[model samples]
Target: MEENTDINLSSGKVESPSGRDDGDKFNLQRKIFVGNISYRVKQHQLTKHFSQFGTVDYCYVVKDHLKKWSRGIAFVTFQDKKSMTRALQATDEELMLDGRLMRVAPAEESKRVSYSEGANWQTRLPPSLPTQTQDGDTCESDFHCSEQVTLPNVSHLELDACGECAIQRLYDDSLMLIFSFLSVKEHVRVERVCRRWRHLAQKSWNRQHKLQFRHMFKGFIKGLTDSILNSLLQRCGVYLRALDLSASPQLLSDLCADSIGANCPNLTELNVSGASVTDVSLRTIAQACPKLRGFIQERSFYVGDKGLTSLFQGCQSLEHVDVQNNAGIVGDCFHSLPTTVKYLNLDHCTKLSDLGLRKICLRCKHLTELYISHCKSVTDQSLINITQNLKRLKVLHMEGSYSQITSSGLKKIGQLIFLKELSLSQNSAVDDGVLVQCAVGCSNLTNFDISGCYKHVTDLGIQALTRCSDLSYLNISYLSHVSDSCVEALATSGKLQSLVARTCSGITDRGTSAEPEHLDTSRSSVTINMYNLSMPHLKADREIMLRPADSSSEEEEEKEEEGGGQSEPVSLCHQSVMAAGAEITSDNEWDVNELDGFECDDYLIGDDPLEEERWSLS
Candidate 1:
């Protein structure tokens, strides 16, 4: 037997490790035998061709033992089981080498080789063959060939295959079986591996009836280079039914609108809140998206009468219009909307008076939900007009401007039996006299917020509101004059969810002021309180500050002292009654220090009449 030779496949060198072929014979993953190679095929060339499948680090073409001539055979050693399998799959016969095809198959055992020196050689042998001797020759007595073998036994081959071969040849039939048994969450994890996998994992975000644009409000238009915004609008505008551009001021401007008009013609829901838009932006939006149903404009976007006219003219399908924080909008804005307009929010529009609201009631008869909070200009007659004309109105919010609505106004609203939600908070003018009328008129009322109406909100107001059988949510906070009895009635009468009654001194069992501790302790508290008191009260509290009375010479001396300068509280009584509201006013001639508290003066008015003559020069 010739000693096995090893070759370095990467470098193509016939290199052998120390003590080769004795105790450390290389383990073969597949049977390795070489035969029928053309005479020109070199070991290096053969190794290079077969090593494409795996590492063939060692290979040798055998030559005649005596003459050392090419014997048309070679031994190839594969680096790993995978390489061995790949070689088997890739080539069974005629693997080209040196421009000549070679016949390839597993090598058969050498019939004449001796292996009898190894222990238990008899049991390891083929059934009829006996063990061989230690030398290069076989043991003749037991080595007789009884029958010819058909093929080599490759049943124990441990060759590892490449990915494509492993999946197609080894696992193709059972591939679905493996994944069919995995849990849903595990499948999701597998699909989250890369872009391709994520594409497979998610369902359609646009499959629903209405595309949800709420979550996209936060960061959709951030630093989007002008080109990108224009491109996106061009691509996605046609199919878009709802486009909520709320909170995106830059993207809703004139430039964006023009681009959108050229692209998005079917847009239905357009929310461009905080855009600070004028009639121009609205006109562009209305023209671009004629099918628009809902429109939302926040604080900065003042949708005056002209914008409303354009919107009503262009977007006839409009259903809801929210013009919040446009304090300058008069009643004329609502005149343009068709009767098809159902929902209107004019919250914080302080300039819209009763006249404008009456126009709204007359024109927008289909109005179901109306929010006119903080419209201090609206009066009871206007609200009466709404209750009488708009029968469909259900949810009404008139908080912060109660002076407009009196008891008679509540009586008018009684005609709308369909009323559900009502808010009268911060309307100090609404007393128990009117709220009882409201409770009687709108018996179906469910949600109510009646905060900050202190002077007039007595227990009678609370008792009347309790009459609503459907009442569930209520807020009666900050009514400083409301007593414990009102809260006790609410705790038992209605189903309240949230109530904010800050500074409601009368209802809270805790005796502290409802104002925040920080606000009460701040510098403005003392100043604000003294500024509102009567002139008689300031004279009564003479110890707090001095008052200038009748004495021309003493006054001149005090003026001289004041010219020298000192920080002093302004005088609260006597001569300066013109400054009744308690604003700080000190001219260059009247130094702040020369004012009442700076220095003692004989001209100072107080309970003691005789002390008015003594001037403290110090």
Candidate 2:
């Protein structure tokens, strides 16, 4: 058997190898010095591997001083002495690295002492360690190390106790606030952490008033059922104010409406446009949601006059009703419509006619905006009724309902001075007389559309509209008789912003080319689109030729002209227009030239071969 010996540096104590003093053993158990490590191993890799056994405070791989290459050795220090003890036990199992086994052991006292005396000893020592001089007094200088190397006084038990106290200091309300910032998915995920978090997450979800499950498309596997609605209502329906089930309305049934009516009593806005709801559901909503303000039941085919009557009778606070495209709705439904309603849209309700509109005008005096477009049954009598009553009307859309409306009705429509936007496109009977009446009466009109009125409208009608100086948007596309004179008149209005005159055969390049001069140059903003015009291609080519050229191209062209031999002579009018276009293209300067006749300078150039007979008149 080999003889064993033990040595202790602190207190100059010595003992047999088998009978080592506990105090000396504890003092030396601070750092584990590993040897025979792979040369390719880094400090962080060693630290990460050793951290699995215990909390490693610091790790260092020794390197060659000049070459900066790993020396196949490293040191790992731990915060507590118990962790060092566990790491020593764990090292008995071979640590494999790059198909090779590593060696680990407690550093020898001589090696530790040499390291303390090295030039980098000040940096290697832990920050929490206190240095002491030979006189037994703590010294502030980092160059010195204590005689005895010991672990920190903190243990695992003290760390656990401190963490628990920190958690206990937070109140329930503060904890809830911190949890509220997490997303709904995160809230559910963290519930598995402990019992307290699960309870708080459940409580927070219950208090949520606004619930939108539109993204959970799979959750509505079955149409919105009474059981599912009741389950949701039991949890959050009491406090719910806004519920959006707009997505997947096919899942909504009559029971879902009843569930909402019974549970969500404070509902203000309801949208069940494409649902399978019937007249029974509408009656239930009217009786249940007394405080309802806005209702949208577009395309709900089963809802007819009976449903409308029930809704109007129960929901007195209703302000907006949009029953668009509901063909079953007839004129008789407006008889029961609440007077409190201000905005009503009966668009595409083909069954509604003048009788229904008359009832609406007589009852709904607070109406400010009405859209009955595409209701072909509506005629001049409907518009006459609207103007007679709803004097507060600001927007009226009568598009596609021009079969029975003539200039006589349009003349009466001009009496509504509050009209700001008017659309009478596709009306064949609208002529210049109606426009004259509109200009004389409604001067505040901002947007006017008569795009498809191809019959009986000419420059006379456009000239009549010039009195409305505030017109910003004008659409007279497809009108065959509107010419450049109308465009010039519109440009001089000074406030025109957008003008759409597509397919108008009378508007030529010359007329549109001169139209810009009459615009409000002080504002410097004008947009004129002449799509599908007779000379669109020619106008595009002319616009390209009018683009300004650089100084090099200009000099080249001048030299070519100076050395001219058989080049064609350019017209004076065309040259002056090119110069004006170039100046405008280069500097954005507008030189508004009059449309008077131009002098061709034909006498100086000799007899011009390309000169037209019209030039002689100029």
Candidate 3:
């Protein structure tokens, strides 16, 4: 009897420990790569050829659009990993089909071998196949040459047996997926091909309606020139709903702006946040994209009141506006800002004062979210204005070192019962009384981050804010005054999905033990980070389960004499996704220090250039 060489094939119930089921075996998919195939071969032919070693589930030959043959490469998927392995082993027999020695491998491994070591990675036959029936001295070439593809179990294949290439018969969606890998230059060149390619090419262009040219940044000095911008706009701008040229600042000249205003009339969101864009471009953009709901010009230092006034006057439907770092524009344009504007961000406008903010609060009374960070000139008058005018505000971020804002201002803030997200970090105004007031009124608050209030607030304030039934995200990082009681309250609260208590010195063994012990399993997950100092006795509260007498007290004493390792309670209860104990660290999936707790890429890609994945012809 022959010894079985298969790993997990007998019942096909046992899984391969090598993780062969994942798509990494073939990055394009979980398929086997077939190489050195003959040009005349078809999908049915390859399927039949490979069906001997496994149940050939799928087969595809890669080639050009109109080409009648493959690029000498193909892919096949088997019913099981054992079948794939066996098929790979069978390739050692030369696997000659129509006289070409075919090579088979996992697609990812093949990529590494083919690219790094070149084509020598392909294995050759042992010069002859041993058999009792064949003559001992006869070589494979001398005995017989493979002149035709012979599929043993497959007698005839009427479906897809002809030499027509698979690439030419791809559906419209598949063709668009292929064209999506092409660059702007390639898209332009692709249209100059046959009309079928052009139709599919236009569909591919129309697929992504947002025209973000940030990926096309060629160099630090160069950008998408006016001509190229106009060309792309002429092709895709009719369907384009948003245009983002924030990263490609070199394309912000008057001519580029003119082309954008002329071409992208239906655009609703525009981000031209570079220092080089002028008032002329801003005014032109205002005259054009009137349906613009969101406009971001964060660092445009040259833009002044005239351009902003023009923009606000024209874009009456604007809902979200970010003019954070533009110091050139003052409050003279405040009246022009639309009443429909619901979200406004003015983070670092050094020239903006309480007067400007009051004008905005009076005009855009329906504002839902507002951010005014690091603007030193803003005082209690702005907060008062916000409470009186913007009664519908749900999010308010006044997170900068502002001594001008007093407790009275925060008391007025409590009047806005609709507030859900509030940040008063680094401001000295927050105290226990104000927190109690806000907690009583704003029970609907979900996200509260007051990390820098170390001087004034203590456990009294922290506990008061925790009373807000809806508060799930709390960041009391540097609150050195808060004690273990706060941690206990938070654990039993059952609503805190995320807790960031970084340097709260009062959290020791007591706090750590109380967290997991009092954890409310009603909530699906809870992440607690206590990263001041390492607590060595964290496992003191855990109930130990003793084993048999064979591993008795003497052995336990020996282990204890060495070191009975103790685990910190910082590991989130109920198997939360992330945990931090001695130090706050992330497993690259989430950021520990970022305010949102998720990596920037989790929301979007920040600062990193958008590198579009381009498909290489392999």
Q: How many clashing residue pairs appear in each of the predictions shown?
A: 11, 1, 0
Give the candidates in order of TM-score, highest first: 3, 2, 1
Which portions of model 1 miss their true places by more than 4 Å?
1-226, 250-252, 402-411, 491-502, 508-618
Poorly placed runs, candidate 3 (over 4 Å) = 1-186, 192-204, 214-223, 514-618
Q: Per-residue lDDT of 437-491 in model 1, one digit per residue for the tens? A: 7688788888877766665777877877777877877766556566777666665
All candidates: TM-score: 0.50, 0.55, 0.56
| Candidate 2 colliding pairs | 224-251
Q: Local distance difference test, per candidate?
A: 0.59, 0.69, 0.68
On lDDT, the stronger of 1 and 3 is 3
User: How does residue 133 of candidate 3 score in lDDT?
Assistant: 22
**For model 1, the run of ten residues with the poorest summed lDDT:** 153-162
Tens-digit lDDT string for candidate 2 (231-297):
6665556677667666667766777887888788887778787877788888998898888788888
RMSD of each: 19.8, 19.5, 25.3
Residue 64 CA displacement from its true place in model 2, Å: 54
Ranking by lDDT: 2, 3, 1
Give the candidate number with the greatest TM-score. Answer: 3
